[model samples]
Target: METPIDRIKLSQTAKDQLLKLRRNTKIDQWNILCRWAFCRSLAEPTSPSPVPIPQDSNVEMTWRVFGGEMSDIFLLALKQRCYNDGFPTDKETLATQFRLHLHRGIGYLAGDPNIKKIEDLVELATKKI
Candidate 1:
């Protein structure tokens, strides 16, 4: 069966941000870093901007790699998030929300100063942004 989320690509800014996050967290895989970014963005209370992010960077990954073993769960959560945000859960909307959340999460990881270690990600659970 075809994956619901086919491919993920970052913008130039997000890619740069992910580079910083990779250095800080020492998690080398793009998919792993992206997973952190995805969940980080989801934990936030505000919805991501609906503005479309340009897919201008070279970084790319298949949905399976990005979501790994929990691919279905991640896709379902994303679709659910779209529904919760009062948006349609159609393919286009799902893809857009996924990109929006991914970029926003990357920004969250890159912009934080205290995220130098992997353990610091746990702080996201307790700290208010």
Candidate 2:
């Protein structure tokens, strides 16, 4: 991705603002930015939203009215379930939650695993060859 030129340029005010943000923030803010990029990467400008809305409503409302959020919605649902279940959201709890989804999600993302072991794979390949 190209670095967008700031019309404000490298003014002292911009530099100071960035320094303040860095000191206050714990995590790298750049990775969070990638999520916005990933979401935008999905759709094209040519394919407009099916439902149009009034001029007054904001962009967030615009998305809520006409668009679907695959990633953000999944995360929001995940947190909501965690909230209801009273889980601490630590490694163990997350692992258990992940297992429930992973088992099903993997089946859809990857083809069904017929063989369980590398030995089985080698045996099958040798027989075929």
Q: Which candidate leads in lDDT?
A: 1
Which pairs of residues collide in model 1?
none
Output the lDDT of residue 45, model 2.
23
lDDT per residue (tens digit) for residues 34-111 in model 1: 998899898877899878799899999999999889898898888778888898988887888889999999988899
Report the lDDT tens digits of candidate 2 across residue range 5-82.
111112233233323433433223422222222222221222112232222311121212211345446345444454
Minimal lDDT window, size 10, model 1: 1-10
The lDDT for every candidate, in the order shown, is 0.86, 0.31
| Candidate no. 1 TM-score | 0.91
Candidate number with greatest TM-score: 1
TM-score of each: 0.91, 0.24
